[model samples]
Target: MTGNTHIVGGIAASLAYAQFTNHDPIIMLAAGVVGALLPDICHTGSKIGRKLPLLAKLVNKLFGHRTFTHSLLFLVMMAAILNAFMPFEAVTAGILVGMVSHYLLDMATKNGIKLLFPIKLTVRLPITTKTGSKVETIVFSALTLLSFYFGYEAFRFYL
Candidate 1:
């Protein structure tokens, strides 16, 4: 999936989580966007990668795209790191949700991801689409609608 799709998925997932947990939606949304872009740091051509070229190159060289950075091991490490350094539970929760959303969106792509990492197993849904394809645009649109719904639900108290 493209970065924009991942972003929409992150927003949708984060808003849903905020609504369910009654956390601060604003913080969750911000963290979600950050987490959504984290995995693609392994791809130098990615949005995040472009911003941090040196780090992106190192990560890309060390693990390659859709390998360690997209794996469960990376998620676990992130969870641990966030737990230790992050003072806000909402931020941690949002980031994790966004990261999960990232991989879930990627799972819909033709290339898929190495969800299990060291095991070298590729994981994806039965139905997959090429990145940036018409189907992906449809998925992006659907996710955008979902984000709007979740956002409305999460912020209804303020409405």
Candidate 2:
């Protein structure tokens, strides 16, 4: 998935979380951004990956793509750890929303993510859409529109 998609997913997920939990919109947005980029830390080409290339390389070497990082187990463990050390509601909400966005965005690609990694069961949607293709272009455009709408809504709420 592209960075724009991640940002859109983050915004949408954050907005949804805010609506559900009634937490501060800023906090939920922050969490959503973190969640959306967290999973891609394992991929060298991801946004966060460029910031921490060595760590990304290490993760890639150790686990490879769509294996450990993309698994439900990884998300659960992350949530558990965050819940233990951080504020339960905010952290858990952020992580879950982010992971969900990541999973959904990846699913939009031609080579879908290994959602149930380590189980060797690949779950891909029937629709085939390559990243940066026409489908992706349309999807990203829609996401951008949604993000802008959500951002406007959030601003209105806060202001």
Candidate 3:
């Protein structure tokens, strides 16, 4: 999925998470956006990768794309890291939602991610679509609409 789609997914995930918790919606959304793009740091051509070339290149060299960062282990490690530093449970949950949303979206692709990494267990949806294709466009659009709807719902107090 493109960065924009990931962003939409992140926003939707954050909003959904907030519905069950009292965390500040804006902060959760920000963290969610970060989490959404965090997986792509392993790809040198990704949105975050372009901003941090050295780190991206090193990650690409060490783990390759859709392998390590996309793994469940990596997600667990991220949760641990956030738990250690972040005081808010809701914040941590928001971040995890974003990361999980990214993985779910990636699962819709043909190559799919190695969810278990070294274990090489690939998990994907039965049907998949090519990245940046018409199908992806449809997915993006739908996710975008969902994001907007959820965003409004979450921030209705402020609006």
Highest lDDT, which number?
1
**Residue pairs in collision within model 1:** none
Per-model TM values vs. the true structure: 0.98, 0.90, 0.95
Full ranking by TM-score: 1, 3, 2
Query: What is the lDDT for 138 in model 3?
Result: 92
Scored by CA lDDT, what does every candidate get?
0.93, 0.78, 0.89
Stretches off by above 4 angstroms in model 2 are none
lDDT of 1 by residue, 1-159 (tens): 888998998999999888888679999999999999999999999989999999999999999999998999999999999999999999999999999999998998888899999888899989999999999999999989999998898888888
TM-score of 1: 0.98
- The TM-score obtained by model 3 is 0.95
The 10-residue segment of model 3 with minimum total lDDT is 88-97
